[model samples]
Target: MSMYVRVKRQDQTVFLRAEASDTFRTVKVALGDILSLVLDDIKLYGKDKETVLEDEGTLGGFEIGNDDVIFWGQRMDGSTFEPASGN
Candidate 1:
């Protein structure tokens, strides 16, 4: 069955129609279309901003159900991580 989910990116909110069986890759594709970004560059997180939604796993397997809100963020690369507080 198809379900609705919310995707938050900065100040923009996007409602998406997806199935629990859908993979994160599928969501990335749709988000790319809506957000006008490269499909392979889109990454997703949870409300906590720490739970990464990786590919090769079903949405259901991630325990994501109907009406879930996923936060959109940039994919981490070699230079993405940095120290928050440095002397």
Candidate 2:
């Protein structure tokens, strides 16, 4: 089963076809491919915008499902953040 989700980085957001049963680690891998960054180098955020998503576990565990939004950036954890760049 696949879900379409919104993912943003810097000034752009892309709609991605994500496998629903995949782990957050899988999302990292796909984002790595899309954003040209290594898996370890990417950072992810959810709706709260304060929690850094480091979970290697499944997206279902995070309560994320279809049509969710995941914000991504190159900024390291603890670095200064601007408001997520896209809607």
Candidate No. with top lDDT: 1
**Worst 10-residue stretch by lDDT in candidate 1?**
78-87
For candidate 1, what is the TM-score?
Answer: 0.79
> Which ten-residue region of model 2 has the weakest summed lDDT?
78-87
lDDT of 2 by residue, 1-87 (tens): 788877876678867787767776778788788768777666678766656777576667777788998887675565654454455
lDDT score, candidate 2, position 59 = 69
lDDT of 1 by residue, 1-87 (tens): 999878877667788899999998888888888878776667677656677778777778887889887777654583352111111
Please provide the root mean square deviation of candidate 1 (C-alpha atoms, Å): 5.4
lDDT of 1 at 70: 78
Looking at model 2, residue 38 earns an lDDT score of 74
TM-score of 2: 0.76
**Cα-based TM-score, every candidate:** 0.79, 0.76
